[model samples]
Target: MSPERYARINQMLDNRQTDLTLCLDTVHKTQNIAAVIRTADAVGIHQIHAVWPDAEMRVSGNTASGSQQWVKTLQYSSMSEAAKQFNLQGMQVLATNFSDKAVDFRDIDYTKPTVVIMGNERDGVSDEGLAIADQHIIIPMLGMVQSLNVSVASALIMYEAQRQREQAGMYGTRQLDEAYCQKMLFEQGHPIYAKACRRKNIPYPSIDAQGQIEANATWWQRMREPDPNADEA
Candidate 1:
C-alpha cells in the first residue's frame, strides 16, 4: 500500500473499537452473510462470529467486495461455543427476536461491549442462541411485511451502533489500544512481506507512518536493488 493509504488506515484503526461484534447463527445464504460482513466492516466492527453446522459457508468475491479481509471472520460449529467464548471475554450477547422480554432496539446501550446476534434467514435465531443472550431486541415494524431481510436487519443494527458510538465518542481516539494499532498498521502497509514472514515464523520489518522501513533497512534496500547476476546488454 502507498504511504498515504497506510496513514489513512492507521487513522481508521485508531478509531476502531473492539468492544462491539456481530454474531450470525446458522445463516445459510451466502449473499446475506456477505452483505452482513460488508456492513460490519463499514461500521468498524472488530470481529464477526459465524456459527454453521458444517463448513459450507462461502462468500463470493463480488458479494464480499474485500470487506472480509478487513473484518476478522471467525467460524464455529455451535452457537453455544461461540456464545461461551464471547461471554468468557465479558461481552454481552444480545439476540434479535420477538419475545415478551424483547426491548426496543433504540433503547439498548451500545457503549458496552456487545455482540449483536442475528438468526437464520427463515427460522430466526436458534433456541439455544436465544437462551444465552443477555437480552433480546426487536426493531418495531409497522409495515405489512413484518420482517426485514437478515442482511438489512444486521445493517440497521450495526449502523445504529455506529451512530450511538459516534455520539458517545466511542469512535474517537483510543478506539484500538496502542499495541494493536501498531500491529495492524504494519500488516496493512506490507501485506505480502507480512505473509512471507508469517509463513517462515519471522517477524515482519516495521514501517513508520510514511511507509519507510524501520527494522533491517539494509536488507530491504539490498532486495530492491537490481540483480547484477542477470545478463544485460
Candidate 2:
C-alpha cells in the first residue's frame, strides 16, 4: 500500500461508528440497496445487515460508485436471525413503519447502540421485522406522500443518529478497539498478503511506517512455511 492509501484507510477506520448499524428486510432493488450503502458510509456507519433470504443483495456499479467497498454489508437468511444477533450485542432495534404505537424518528435516544431497520419499499416493515423491533419510528409526512423512500428514510435516520452521537462526543475520538483497527487496516489495505497469512496460519506481517512490507526478512520466510495438518490433495 502507498503511504497516502494507508493514511486514508487509517483515518476512516479511526472515525468509524462501531455502535451504529443499519438493517434492511427483503429490499431486493439493487439501486435502493446501493443508495442505502452510500448514505451509511457518509454517516460513518461501518457495518450494515441486510436480509434478502431468496437472493443475494445486489447493487449496481453506477449506484454504488465504490461506496460498497468502504462499508461492510452482512447478509442474513432471516430477519429473526439478524435481530437475535443485534439483540445479543445490546443494540436497540428500531423499525420504520406506520403504526398506532410508532413515534417520531427524532424523539428516540439515538446515542445508544442502535440498529435502524428498513423494510420493503412498497409493503413497509413486515410483521416479523416489527415484532423483533424494540420500537417503531416514523418519519413525519408533511406533503402528499405518506412516507419517504427507503433510502431517503435511511439517510434521515442515520444523520439523526450521527447528530445525537456527535452531541455526546462520540466522534471526538476513536471508538474502535486497537486490535480491530489493526485487523481492518491489514485486511482492507493489504488484502492479498492478509489472505496469505490466514492461509498459512501465521500472524499478519507488520507493515512499515510507509505501509510497505519487509519482503526479504527471516520471520517472513518462516511464515511462508506450509502447514502439515495432513489435508493433502
Candidate 3:
C-alpha cells in the first residue's frame, strides 16, 4: 500500500465503533441492504447483523456496493439467534416497531452498546423480534406516511448513535483490537495479495506500521506456488 493509503485505512480503523451495530430482521430488499451498509460505513460502524432465512436472498445480497466489503455482515438463521447474540454481548436490543408503548428513537441513549433491529420492508419486525428486544423504538413521522424506508430509518438511528457517541468521546481513541487492526490493514490495504492469500489458503502475513507485508522469503515463495488443497476443493 502507498503511504497515503496506509494512513487513510489506519485512520478509519482508529475511528471504528466496535460496539454500535444494527440488525436486519429478514430485510430482503437488496437496495435497502446496500444503502444501509453504505450509511454504516459512513458512520464508522465496522459490522452489522442480518437474518437471512432465504437461500436465494443470501447469495444476491452479497452483491451490494463496495461498502459491503467494508462493513462485515454477520448472518443468522433466525431472529431468536440474533437476540441471543445481543444478550451475550450485553447489547441493548432496540426493535423498530410502532406500538402504544414504543418510545421515540431519539429518546434512547445510544452511547451504550446497542443493536437496533430494523424490520423487513413488507412484513416489518417479526413477532419474536419484538418480543426479544429490550426496547421498542420508532421514528416520529409528521405526515400521513407512518414510517420511512428501512435503509433510511437505519441511517437515522445510526447517526443518532454516532452523535451521542461523539459527544461522549467514544471515537476519541482507537477501540478496535491491535491484531484486528493489523489484519484489516493488510486485507483492505493490499487487495491483490490478500486475494492470493485466500485463493492459496496461505496464512495472512503480519503488517508493519507502514502497512507493508512482513513475511520472509519462504512465505513469498509459497505465494507463487499453486495451492496443494485446490484439488481437494
Question: Which structure among the candidates has the greatest TM-score?
Answer: 3
lDDT of each: 0.83, 0.84, 0.88
TM-scores vs. true structure, each candidate: 0.86, 0.83, 0.92
* After superposition, candidate 2 runs with Cα above 4 Å error: 177-180, 187-204, 214-233
Instruction: Give the alpha carbon lDDT tens digit for every residue of 73-175 in model 3.
Output: 9999888888888988899989999998899999999999999999999989999889998899999999999889999999999999999999998885788
Q: Residue-wise lDDT of candidate 1 within 168-207, one digit each (tens)? A: 9877576666666667777777777676555555555656
Better of 1 and 3 by lDDT: 3
Better of 2 and 3 by lDDT: 3
Candidate 1: pairs in clash: none
> In what order do the candidates fall by TM-score, top score first?
3, 1, 2
With candidate 2 superimposed using the best TM-score fit, by how many Å does residue 101's alpha carbon deviate from the native? 1.4
Which prediction has the highest lDDT against the true structure?
3
Off by over 4 Å in 1: 177-180, 195-202, 217-233
Q: At residue 198, give the lDDT of candidate 3.
A: 90
Which ten residues in a row are the worst by lDDT in model 1? 221-230
User: What lDDT, from 0 to 1, does candidate 1 have?
Assistant: 0.83
